[model samples]
Structure formats: C-alpha cells, structure tokens
Target: MTTQKALIVGASGGIGQNLVQYLSEQEAWKIVGLSRSQPPLKSTAQFIAVDLLKRDDVVTKLEKLTDITHIFYTAFYGGPTFSVPVAENLAMLTNVVEAIEPVAPLLERIVLIQGGKVYGRQIGPFKTPAKGFAEK
Candidate 1:
C-alpha cells in the first residue's frame, strides 16, 4: 500500500500541533508541518518554516511536496478589525491551495479549520452555542 502524506499548514498553532502528533502516530502517514515557527513538540514529522501571506514563499517551499495526499489548513491571521482578518485569512488559505495544487499531483483532499468566529463570536456573545449552519 502507498503511504499517505499529510501537509499540516499552521502547524505551530494548537490545532495544527495536535494534528501533527496524531498523524505522526499513524504508521501509514508521512507528516509535513508548515508554519512560521517550528512547533514546540518533537515528532518524526518534517517541519517547514513558511509565511503563508507571501505567495512566493509558499510556492517555493511547497513545490517539493509532490507526494502530499491531504492538507489540513489550520492557519489563521487575525486583525483588530473584522474585515482585515477576513481578507488576510482568505489570502493565506488561497496561497497555500494555489501553491500545492499544481505541484502536488497526488493531492486529494483539503481540510479547512474554522472556529466560533464563523458564527459571529468575535462580534459578541451568542444566545446559544454555535452549531453547523445545516443544523436546526
């Protein structure tokens, strides 16, 4: 069986770090962690320091990950204003996708990680817990 390779972007964040650990334990997975700084935990996974805001940097760094099968995108860029964060976060995610799609021919899936902010949590307290939009 062919080994599955996973690229975890924003690997230094809480969710990203956890994913790195989980994937590292799976014998069938080869893990690659991408972030601005190396994660504090030690693991067999390979680490790449990359600024997702810069398309050139993302493209250059990710081009060699030709064996990647999946991408877990946990990277987030926050700003004081809502619009700023929205724009920057989108740009970062776009950079990663654009960079990987062309070079990683084996890529099959991309997972985007989002939190309560998507339900307007940042604006104010919610009357009820945030749930998936499809949930009634």
Candidate 2:
C-alpha cells in the first residue's frame, strides 16, 4: 500500500515539531512541515516554509497538494488585552480548514491543536490563541 501523506503547520512550535518527529519516525507517513522562517526541525528533509497569515500563499499551497491525507495545524497569534483569542483561533482554525478544504476532497483527516480550555482571565496572562503553543 502507498504511504499516507501528512501536512504539518506551525512546525517550529512544540507540538508541531514533536508531531512531525513522531509521525516521521512512524515511517508509515510522508510528512510535509510548514513554518514562517521554515526553521529546521528534527527532520529538515520534509519542510515547507510558509506564512499562514498570507491568504494567497495558503490557497496556493493547498491547491498544489493532491497527495495529502492528513493535516496537523498548530499556528497561533497570541498577546495581552485579548478577549478575541478564542475568536482569533476560530478564524485561524477556519483558515487552516479552508486551506485544506481543497485537499479535503482527497484527504482523510486534518487535526488542529485546541488544547485544554482555560476558562476566565485567570491569575496570569494567556499565552496564545492556539491555547497551547503561543507564538512569540
């Protein structure tokens, strides 16, 4: 059987990178990693430098992918004085969803990290809109 293909976004972040390594180690998957600076991860061979915030780029990349079977998205825009992190994450989540919308025609799965929900403002500041891996 042919190996499955996976596209990973936010590959420079914690969960993203870990997932890449884990999936690559599986040796059953063809992994494609995406990032802004395209920072080299544990496995550099499967990497694509992309700024997900750019709509055109996202659409173009998604269009070119025909073999992708799954996607793991961990991108985020985080900061202080934020009540919209949830909404922002929802938008980005939608962006990733839409980007892969085309691939969905052929893909088997797409996973976005929602992490454990942290309710209220709490004692400290919220890290990222992604909930887990907040970008600096």
Candidate 3:
C-alpha cells in the first residue's frame, strides 16, 4: 500500500489544526502543514511557517513538494488580515492555485475552505455585477 501526502495551507487555524490531528493517525498520509502563525500541535506532520501572501516565497516553498497527493487550502483572511480589493483577493487565490499547477497533476483533490462569501462578499453596480452578500 502507498501512503498519500497532503499539503494543508492553514496550519494555525481551527479547521487546519483539526485536520492535522485527524490525518496524523490515518497512517496513510504524510501531512505537510503551512501557516504564518503556527500554534501548538501534536502531530507527526511536517509543519512549515509560510505566508502565502508572498507569491514568490510561497511558490518557492511549495515547489519542493512535488509528490503532494492532496491539498487542504483552509487559509482565510478577515478583519485586518488583508487590504486588497475583492478582485485582488480572488487573484491572490488564483496565483496560489497556479503555484500548485504542476504538482496538481498528481493530486487527487484540492479542498479549499469557503463560506457564505461565495455568494458575493462585495456587491456593486460599478460596471460590474451587483447583489452583495449578507453579513453573517
């Protein structure tokens, strides 16, 4: 039997933390955790302290993981986390996706954690679509 390797992009987060705990015991996965602020965790996972906002840095780091079989992208930003526009946010995500483009060929799945904002976090009629999302 072969063990699968997973790259988790939000190691310090609530969901990311929980994932590490669960996958650690599976014995079928070699976990690689990515985060800017890493909290205390008990898992036999390779944890990397990275800030995905820096595209080059992130790309360089992820380039080393060519055998990754899955990606758990649970990274998020709220409050004072990001200062870019909505389109930029989407672009940032797109850039991150691009970083994994090569490695993704071997991946079975890429799970990105999204919430209500998927409907429309920001809505405007400025030569674009309208109907913003309601606050949670």
Best by TM-score: 1
lDDT of 3 by residue, 11-62 (tens): 7887889999999999898999988866699899998776677888778878
Between prediction 1 and prediction 3, which has the larger lDDT? 1
For each candidate, the alpha-carbon lDDT, in order, equals 0.86, 0.68, 0.73
Q: For all the candidates, what are their Cα RMSDs to the real structure?
A: 2.9, 5.6, 6.1
Candidate 1 lDDT over residue span 1-136, tens digit each: 6789999998998789999999898889999999999989878899999999999999999889999999999887767765336678889999999999989989999999866666666677777767643356
Better of 1 and 2 by lDDT: 1
Per-residue alpha-carbon lDDT of model 2 for 1-136, expressed as tens digits? 6688888877887778788888877767888887876656566337767666677777776677777888887776553753436666666667666877765576887787633333334345664553433432
As a whole number from 0 to 100, the lDDT of residue 11 in candidate 1 is 94
TM-score, cand. 3: 0.75
The most accurate candidate by lDDT is: 1
After superposition, candidate 1 runs with Cα above 4 Å error: 81-84, 120-124, 129-136
TM-score of every prediction relative to native: 0.86, 0.73, 0.75
* Model 2 TM-score on a 0 to 1 scale: 0.73
